[model samples]
Target: MRVFVLDAKKRSLDPCHPARARQLLKSGRAVTYRYYPFTIILKDRLVENSVTHPHRVKIDPGAKVTGLALVRDDISKVVWAAELEHRGEIIHQRMLERASLRRSRRSRKTRYRKPRFDNRRKPEGWLPPSLESRVANIITWVKRLVRWCPVSAISLELVKFDTQKLQNPEISGVEYQQGTLFGYEIREYLLKKWSRRCAYCGREDVPLEVEHIIPKSRGGTDRVSNLTLACHECNQRKGNMTAAEFGYPHIQAQAEQPLKDAAAVNSTRWAIFEQLKRFNLPVEVGTGGITKYNRVRLGLPKTHWIDAACVGESTPKELFVKCSSVLVIKATGHGRRQRCRTDRYGFPAAHAPRRKKYMGFQTGDLVRAVVPKGKCVGVHVGRIAIRCRPSFKLNGFDVHPKYLKILQRSDGYEYEIHSVSSPGLKAGAPDAI
Candidate 1:
């Protein structure tokens, strides 16, 4: 335990004060002792032994210590303590008056262990679907903005781009635009400036060319002001001479397309917000359904579903989503009755298939069967007895239908069901019948 001595009148243990001293009397379990001018706080016993020199002591702010032991060797033991202002009568030098200190010392040891839900089959929490969706929408908007922003303005805009969430892979979902040429490179620039058409001929008849109003070989520098779009044939014919020198009238032009600053182009936050506006969701949700839906819509796959039950009372809540892939949540309500099936749009649904579908198999239909070990195996190609247990008896052998997922007749091993495209005549033609 640690101890500190303080002046009764001046609570501050100033180093220059003669009455201040802080010390460690003992260490282990926890106890205390009094030693004349100063008291020793210890674990088991108090040692009354006196030393030649009082060790200089420093106390943490707000700690209180008392007793004559605070002073030692005819000098003040307190050094480097805050000065306590105001004077009090020193009727007796270093009087050992004291009171009880009741606060307990905190443990310094740390704990390391895995959480309790390590092997839990289901997720602990699920965000409301709406919140998840809105958050997802916001993230997607931001990601798309980064993708379509102008190249020249990208570098500067990236500087002001909110990096607070850039590290979150679920939020950024950004793929940097790629091409070897500089942003100002003519072909791409022209594509941006003129919409990929020849300005002079006003035709998209062929690939366009960047022709100089004043030729570079004739002292014309590479400047947008001296450039115009031309067809390849026209560019070759114009060569290094001004249109005026070639006996053509000069075409005056206004700034039809001004270059976007890299900063303006790169700043994609506004675009992201615009994109997020479409995902109308409640700021709060009932059971995290909204949050989960938004996440699924936005294509964020990694955000863990959170349930409302496990959160702390004081914790602030927020749903998180991404713009990259599906977030599938399996339902545990059914007793594995859920079968794989597709919805109206051909996307996989979370619900399982009905049991009646399994009844579609017929005795004469080509079906794979699994067999138990033995050189002698049952080969029943025709219709056989139908047992109430849902097994078919062929050639005096009984087999369960569940094995159909992995059964192949010739190999004597189990075979999976028919592929979706060719689900056998019975299943394939069910609607027709």
Candidate 2:
């Protein structure tokens, strides 16, 4: 990915090539500013004298992971891309654990407290903590990118699948109910529901055909619940027999179940869309249909960032991907607020340090330590966990704070650059930098 650049006055400028940034640093023209999204500050340049093009920040929001892309629309080029992994599941689990602990403590106490469940009223637009975190994560990154780059517009994939329409097609009115694109929506929903594999044979990497669980001749309608994907062999072998008669009763049951991930995206998509409007930029919204169509039309592989780049109708016919790497950011929130740590049985295991920082070093701060002579005898660079003593944990090695130099403060998120030849091409093959 290209390196973000800022003028001497701390104003955002156009990001420069990695090689150009290197030359600027080596020649004493620019100095390092931030480490995570690797930015630099020029010593001689000013934003007024430099020309910067308008960039669009596109988002492909998901339940667990969201894709972000910084696109130079004027040139139809993608300059930077990132995949943000959310902690909704983690947050949910933590909330459950906290509730369990509270209940246990209350039951063990002598003084009884009355339940006040009905006393609290949720305000309008209220979302569960887990769902709210996803929206916050996307908005945080959008704000960060806007500050780092010249972002003028935003594009978002507002909805992946219309659950209501999928369940009751007639509610969409006659025109859309019989529209050509209706089948496309159903097929996409099925693909995601069945994990893109044959529902009967579990076969993948082959052409999958939509098959009826209960044959239409056998009193089955075209409802989504009766739909299942099958390979040609399975489809032919099963013939007109229902799924239960074909030996897989579970297929029908699973088909009737709603996709939890899809529901999550639907719940928070509008929240993100509305929150983004506060940025005072044109927030373009698109459906999953157009995103997939653009990706297939461009012959690009399926990846979150690529989906983000192909989000809106404004996407160019020809897209130029200018980066060979993508930034993978995972939300690892700051340490918990509880001072006491508990065990699995809700017993106090240990107490946290009263002070978070020691000797000006805190846990999760990126630092570099040079060990003069010891078992860890070389320079170690990584996040550090500080204690009351001078010795601190640096990449699992004990190092004195005197030898440690802070690089970047803790920001509740971990960052890594993954090398990719093309967008979403060989996605599983990521060489970390």
Candidate 3:
């Protein structure tokens, strides 16, 4: 029985109050009929009187007290005792008991209830089962991607407006700071322009927020012309800088796409290659110290590699680096050849086939791992890492490697090969030799 300390006063609990009598009422004590007797504690005194009974005790408002105790299937009998204090000495106390207030719950031998399902309404859609399954899979994939990718990065593409300047700063001297009313105005304008479509992925369902092209603090003006509608994730990834600043290695921006448009633009960059024709590097490559030059010198646009490709949808990794681009086979220091690949948006992609072993999972790769059974159980089950590492590190009870195990192919779907369990490390688990 659950007991509670409701309202406390100077009096000791008494066991003979009407509340105690109510406990007895819950369980049938009278000899005539076996109907369950209802119980009610009319006053605070009755509750205060029943604190010593072995069955239960309580002192509180009637509503809370009522919720605390009830006659149930297994709890057929109840005994209550009251506890109180008075005049420097403990006072009234009472003990109440009741047998079984057996109410007829149900007649087991009765006939079954008639079916009540409606058959008139016909199902609407005509989609095939396989198509529905594919749609579900796509939805799951998109959801996983959203979860895995940083919100800031996604937000940049969705919001396409300047949060720094209200009217043209050159025209109106009003210098609106970042994340201010001007920013909201720019965000609002973009939302109206795009009708809430994701500027990158063309997804219309997800809501978009306003993002700053040039950071507000960096003397960037708050102008609707400069603002864009991007999702929250993309906005965060863009942070407080022009897209031209982030130098990612995996994804590059398209060359034909000019940097003049107000749509959130990310600069694309190609890796420094030994010998290449189609690829363009931002810096001059040589055996001497790496001489980094501005994007203008390399015949490229102003936006950063991160801004042009990583933040926007439909931006392809291959566009950042052409196969014809000279691959810097190796680098001595930051001097001779810094190995560069196309910079990815949120996730780092496998640049070389051989590099896959060194890297773990990416945003979409499905791998079987384990999770702790409960908060403290120490037991675990196989799980999948939906996102990439580095950008997101697995820590504590949720993503710790101590509880992970990758599932292998060919084995039955039910079985999984534990990474730590293996004698030798393979598949990026650990080194076996």
TM per candidate comes to: 0.16, 0.77, 0.16
Writing each residue's lDDT as its tens digit, candidate 2 over 363-387 gives 8998888889978899889998888
Model 1 Cα lDDT, one tens digit per residue, 1-433:
1122323221222121111123232223322222211222323322233122222211110001000001111231111111111111121111111000111111212222222655746543332232223223324322322221110111001123232233223443333333222457766775666677765556786877777766654545455555668788777777766766645544323221222222222333234233333434211112223333433443433212121111112111322211111112111111223254434433446664354223444332334454554443544343343434577755456666653332211211111211112111221221110
lDDT, candidates in the order shown: 0.31, 0.85, 0.28
What CA RMSD would you report for each candidate? 35.5, 11.2, 33.9
Off by over 4 Å in 2: 110-115, 164-258, 423-433
Stretch of 10 with least lDDT, candidate 1: 60-69
**Reference-based lDDT, residue 220, model 1:** 51
- lDDT-superior candidate, 1 or 3: 1
**Candidate 2, residue 203: CA error in Å?**
35
Residues 346-406 of candidate 3 have per-residue lDDT tens digits of 1224443323221444322223344446553444334233333432233223454444434
State each candidate's clash count: 44, 0, 89
